[model samples]
Target: HEALADIEDELAGLEAQAMAEQQRMALKQALSELPERTQEIFRLNRIEGMTHAEVARHLEISDSSVQKHLSKALAYV
Candidate 1:
């Protein structure tokens, strides 16, 4: 029973890894569909953990623009 439980745990870990890979691929495809600037904003805010204002400052854009881009990116995803 202990061996069986160990196998089950390993299988669960593998399944989780596969699911994570699939989701990563899906996200890549979705990002590809977005415009370059919007993609940058999305990456900054979502991946780099930047705030809307921070992204706007980094890109030399307005906060509203950052929000708009993030909204568009989120909607696309």
Candidate 2:
């Protein structure tokens, strides 16, 4: 019984991992479909662990602009 329970738990973990991978792939596909600058701003903040302010500073844009880009990119995703 213990061994069977362990196997079931491992199988559940694998299934969760698979679902997460699918979500990740879908997100990447969505991002790829966004406009170039929108994709860049979204990736800088989401993928590179940058704050909206940091992204805005790096791109020389306003923080509100960065927020708008992020919102648009999330809509795409």
- Top of the candidates by lDDT: 1
Worst 10 residues of 1 by lDDT: 68-77
Clash list (residue pairs), candidate 2: none
Q: Write the per-residue lDDT of candidate 2 for residues 7-51, one digit (tens) a residue.
A: 999999999999999999999898999999999998899999999
> What's the TM-score of each model vs. the native?
0.96, 0.92
Local error of candidate 2 at residue 5 (angstroms): 0.3
Please give the RMSD of candidate 1 to the true structure.
Answer: 0.6
Candidate 1 lDDT over residue span 1-67, tens digit each: 9999999999999999999999999999999999999999999999999998899999999999999
Candidate 1: misplaced stretches above 4 Å? Answer: none
